[model samples]
Target: MDKRFIEEQDVIFNAKPDAVPYNYRISYKVAQVCLILAKSCWGKSGCLPIKLHMISFALCSKEAMDKLLIFTQSEYAEVPIVRFDPAVNSAVTFGIADGLIFQGQNGKYALTDKGRFFVSKIEKESTVLSAEKKDLSLLSTKLTDAKIKQLSDIWRNIYAED
Candidate 1:
């Protein structure tokens, strides 16, 4: 092995644990999933398929929020572009493990009573996820399950393009 390779390995091995990026942190993703469930799913019966969760999380970005707003205002005249995020699976799993989220018989995810209480705490803070809170509240229950299904089909078509 080259001397440089050994030095790089030493550096990596000796490095201390760094802080995880906010997006990748389990707690952050869990909170995001819970907030999405509370705002988007609760009104419709407190559950949404994993696809909806992925799409909803994708919309959390400021750019995606703009797209979502346009879609909502235009009455879905055109399908807005949305991308699937696999990272949401990890978050959902963590939520399930912690008893903050549950899967229904239909394989949809919903907030548990514990999850609702956690969300209440998040809501009362008025600081955590403040921008996301505003955005999600504006979108509460607007993207129905049927609409989400349509959106997924549209997304599939978009990705299928050569």
Candidate 2:
């Protein structure tokens, strides 16, 4: 994995709840993309360009891209990813500007100060509680009960259909 990409994921994994919902959502998705790109780029010469980044990230689901465009439009009023090129595969051709993610000409996305603070707080909390350690015991019990009830309802429905 690319060192920078791993660092970026660490930053995201630690993201705080107080962040603007839109920004947080975008940052998280982008960070995930970076991790995948970085893994693919390991020991390779050239880094994957923005177009490839979009393709790599959007491959699993356009849901990520759709949410990103919505966030960018609402937050920065920018529509960088609007263009679609036919020459490349439809999946890979969608391009967005770097400015929407990175502030300067670093050619890579870095979190803003607010983004950093939010991530730091979240990371700290995550370390303290850990997902498994956190108390969701009650919720888990309720969820199991709900699932059982739903299955029972489905069984009744199947018999009624006959």
Write the residue-wise lDDT of candidate 2 on 59-85 in tens digits.
333454454334323533323232222
Candidate 1 structure lDDT: 0.68
Residue pairs of candidate 1 with colliding backbone atoms = none
55 in model 1: Cα distance from truth in Å? 4.5
Off by over 4 Å in 2: 1-12, 15-30, 56-162
The runs of at least 3 residues in candidate 1 whose Cα sits more than 4 Å from the true structure, single-residue gaps closed, are: 1-19, 54-60, 75-78, 155-162
Q: After superposition, how far is residue 16 of candidate 1 from its true place, in Å?
A: 10
lDDT (C-alpha) at residue 110 in model 2 = 38
| Per-residue error (Å), model 1, residue 59 | 4.2
lDDT of each: 0.68, 0.34
Instruction: Please give each candidate's TM-score.
Output: 0.75, 0.25
Q: lDDT tens string, model 1, 1-162? A: 221101211211122277666766666677888888888887426566544554455556877776666665665566665555555778788788878889887778888887777787778767777887888888776677666667667777877776
Instruction: Extract clashing residue pairs from model 2.
Output: none
**Candidate 1 minimal-lDDT segment of 10 residues:** 3-12
Whole-model lDDT, candidate 2? 0.34
The TM-score measured for candidate 1 stands at 0.75
